[model samples]
Target: MSKVYYTPWRNDLEMVDKFNKILRKSNFLDNIEKDDRIAIKLHIGEYKNFAHVHPLYIKGLVSALLEKDCEPFLTDTTTYYCGHRFSAVGMLKNAFYHGFSFANIGAPFIVADGLGDDKGFSVKVRSPLNELFVPNLFREVDKMIVFSHCKGHGLTGFGGSIKNVAMGCVTKKSKLDMHKVVKFCYNDALCDGCDACKDVCDREIPLMENGKRNLSLEKREDCMHCPACMEACSRGAIKLEELEKIAQVLPLAVEGIYKVLGKENVRSINWGANIVEYCDCMPFPGRTIGKNTGIYLSDDIVAADKAFLDDVNKSTFMIDGRPDPEIQTIEGEKIGIGKMDYERVIL
Candidate 1:
């Protein structure tokens, strides 16, 4: 069983202190050595969203890493979603605005997948996500630290460490690939070939064949599963059932990330405060899903997320539309990312 370190929610001052204490006690940073180029993977939330993992905790993490004489940089990939974070230029501006700059967090904020997505390389993993397009940034980093906010997720119930890596580690194409596992469903009967789906799609995914709307295999690769065709159809034609596959394929994505960045070279930290019904990628978190919990730090991503999942479920339960929280843990254990069976040591 893997080990997970824990501490209850405390006030701001003690919170940062306990963050450092927990790291020291757990000895999680001992592996990070002098001159190691480390990538601090974080999701600096999009556009005016204040509920992302607090900057104070992130600053503390940077300070701790620097003390060890390792090279650390705050990094995250651009979103597939079009917004302030769609491109590297916009993402940097927003991250700096959110207080993740070198001045505030003591590290430069770098967008892992720059403008073209050409900088990344691919790595093979288990089935479901046989290959993942990860940013080339992993090619240089010696170690990684994943700092994720524990909260409700539409696909994986509550996203902690697992969701962060699966969706957050890879490039734009891989992000869409995870969602596309549940391919586009089409009903030839309902499709009128009205060009409604065609007109709406920016990717030009819909096709006209035999006077019926079709999801052409050639063009389908680029499908964002945005479900624009499904929404635009006045008729009951196109269906992209459950586009978010974070629960089923998340572990594979995590395993893929591990394959590139060796499992031993990374540590996962889930900040359990600001628990909410949606992920940070959203415009805004609506409300607290449960009482604020503390932090879960571990060498094992699966173990860390599992501890966070257990608490949030008992306190507030999954939201109406979310998936079973155990799915990610079960799958992660199945794929050997880390076992669900873990010992939680209170810090």
Candidate 2:
């Protein structure tokens, strides 16, 4: 079985010191060889969303890797959504403003998918997506450290190593591709003209009257496909369909990472502190769901995520109407990302 090493969320020790101890206990970096170019894949968060993994912790890991003579750098991809991280220049500026400077983190920050969001290889995976555009940076790296800040997601319930790999490792187009799988449609014939869809749609995408709409659903796709209209309509006018593929499709991106970098060459480290309600992508983020959990390190991505979510569920299950966290692990295992069973090693 996979082994997940643990360390308490304590402030008694410096962040770097605690990180080093956990790394030693878990042997998380044992696979990295000297002179290897390692990419430390991470989510640096959107503008002012400060719950991301601290740079000091990453600096500690970088120091350890440097001591072993391995070449390491921090990397994350562009966001498909229009925001601070939508482009290479914008992302770099935001990362710098967020204190992820090369001077502070002991490594340079790289926009993995490149400036135009056009550097990648199409590798095959499973259902919901045939292939993913694994960024060229991921393909070139000798190894990767998937460092995640464990938190609740409005979509996947919990975002951890699996989410870090699936969403963070791909290009902009592939990110959009994963989201587009869930079909959203509304029938004008079923409308009761209650204006419920209009009230629920925060983006004002739905144009509902007695019957017929001037705009099509295709035009609504330009906005975030949250499709809140499907739920508020008592008349069954709108139907947003998905088979939990949103949860399953995320793991396929991990398969793409494995296809290029090899599973053995990756390690996962989750910062379970600052447990919050939504993903770091949100501008306002969300409220904290539980007390600060500690850290988890494992080679098995699914195992690490499972352990983290298990702890979160002890206090609260649903952070903010998100899907159950178990669904992510179950779907991940179903798609052969990693096993759910694991042996826990306390540091």
Candidate 3:
């Protein structure tokens, strides 16, 4: 019996106005306590990937939180991959540069994991459930207000609030462990013997074979398995063997996040415009595959995400320029996490 609020609008929309309407109608402001340190969880888009939730929208959210005397801070953990937000220093710099400054969004940025990347704690959810994911920073937060930029991912189909928390709240180590699928592999057909993998390998072990650099894991147990070499490989020759395992990790990680959040302290808001078919973590911006719908508010992460998918399908700019809702879930129903069956009240 969860209530989800829908506020549909076009790209030509005023974020501040939408914010006030949504906060008021959804009674989100009513749930806050004065001076509570609220972690406004959100994705600060990777460099050159600009389809993230708007900073202006963040400003409006911050303003609403301030009205209730809630102390809000924009926060997200560093990614495992090497990128603008891969480390605390780099992440903070990227946050500020992306207009997430206290002066701009009316909230300070906080990296959930510590400077050295060891500030996170782990929590186990669904004692007997098969899924086992551990969140680094989710357990440390007092409260969380998730703001998501709805989009599709090449790997997980759709990226929404659940995906945001599953990936966003964890540490790099957790991400790596969860995403680890297979060992490194190189295609001789594509490899021009550039030895880029060898150059990036921390252990300096992978050697060239048959005119191609084949990853040698003789001391594979000693390797940090950062996969930097795999990413750096040109011609897409080097790859990890475990796509299914990496995909399996996202859902398990989500279950862990839910166990930590424990339902009460979490609220989700999704900004549904610029629905790109890829994650914002990419270094390059991708094309928008759908039209801008307004905001959706719900405590049910699954339902709100489903609502977002439905809106995108119904958007005028869809693939066929018609409604075609088909979003494959990363995992099956998030049963105890939240209900997919929701009452959507249009605002």
Candidate 4:
């Protein structure tokens, strides 16, 4: 079992000080050598959804890394969705708008994937898909500190360090490759002809034929596999199957990242504050589903995420009646990434 350090967000202490205490206790800087290029991997929130880990907290982390004489920089990949984060320039602007600017975080902010999304390298994995693409910049870093904002995720039940490494570290092409496992089947017999799927589809893959909604094979080829249609269909006609494939493949992709960076060279921190129901990629700022629980720090990404999920699920307000968030941890352990069993050390 791995040791996960926890520091509760209390009224008696300043949050930044609490974060500093956690960092001091975690011994995170021990992994960093002098002049080591450390990438602080994190998601700068989407436009209008500024619920990610606050830049103040990141400033604290940067200070700690600097104290170790390590070179630290903030890095994230360009998003796949059609939004402000779809390109490198736009993503940097969005990150600046959300207060993750260089002046604020005390580090250079880089979109790990290049301007046109062509800068990445592939790594072989145990999954049947065989390989996953990691951003070229990520490979250059000697070490990484995966800073994640723990929250509920629509596809994976929960998003933390594992999801951060799987989706946040890879290029858009690899993101789509990982998402290809989410097969959506439209049952024509259960179609209500409500045109809901047609209205929400950004790719226009769903068509209205006569009075029924039709998803052609050609259209399926163009499908981006986002769950927009699945969420819009109230009649249960469009069903998302093979979600276990996602649980299995996501950790494998994370393992690929670990293989590139070396398992001992990476550490993770999950900020359990501002726990939103959906990912930070969502355009709108949704409601917070849990209170400011605390911060989790661990060298093991899987153990850190497992502890975060376990703590969040203990709360009454869980997304979709408490879907199994532990699936990622279970799969992570099965693939030799990390262990689900952890020893929580309260600070």
Which candidate wins on TM-score? 4
- For model 3, residues 1-347, the per-residue Cα lDDT tens digits are 77778888844456558667788777765678998888899998997677888798889889888888878998988877666787889989888878788889878898887773664665554322234434455566667889998886544456788778777877766666655443556677888888777887656767888887765657665454454566678688766654434444454566677667666788889888778766788765467778777788887776777677766653422321211223223242543566666788888
- lDDT (CA) for every model shown? 0.82, 0.80, 0.70, 0.83
- Per-residue lDDT over 1-347 for candidate 2, one digit per residue giving the tens place of the 0 to 100 score: 99999887777256558878777656888888899999998988999998888778888888889988999999999987767898999999988988889999889998998894775888987765887887777767999999999987756667889988998888877887887776666676777677777776556766744454434557666655553566577887666556256767887788888989998888899998888877888765578888777889999999999988767663364633446677778877887879899998888
Comparing 1 with 3 on lDDT, the higher-scoring candidate is 1
Regions of model 1 farther than 4 Å from truth: 183-222, 227-245, 314-317
Clashing pairs in 2: none
RMSD of each: 3.9, 3.7, 4.7, 2.2
Model 3 stretches astray by more than 4 angstroms: 125-140, 182-186, 189-210, 218-245, 313-335
Q: Which candidate comes out best when scored by lDDT?
A: 4
Worst 10 residues of 1 by lDDT: 313-322
What is the TM-score (0 to 1) of candidate 2?
A: 0.87
* Ranking of all predicted structures according to TM-score, beginning with the best and ending with the worst: 4, 2, 1, 3
Please provide, for model 1 over 1-347, each residue's C-alpha lDDT reduced to its tens digit, 9 standing for 90 to 100.
88889998887678888998887777789898899999989989878887789888888888888899999999889988667898889998889888888888888987888773644788987777788999988888899999999887654566788888888889988888787776567888888789998987767778888888766788766777764567578896876555335578988998898988899988999998888777788767767878778998999998998888767654354554346777888988987889888998998
Question: How many clashes does the backbone of model 3 have?
Answer: 0
How displaced is residue 266 in candidate 1, in Å? 1.2
TM-score of model number 3: 0.81
As for model 4, its CA RMSD to the true structure in angstroms is 2.2
Please give each candidate's TM-score.
Answer: 0.85, 0.87, 0.81, 0.93
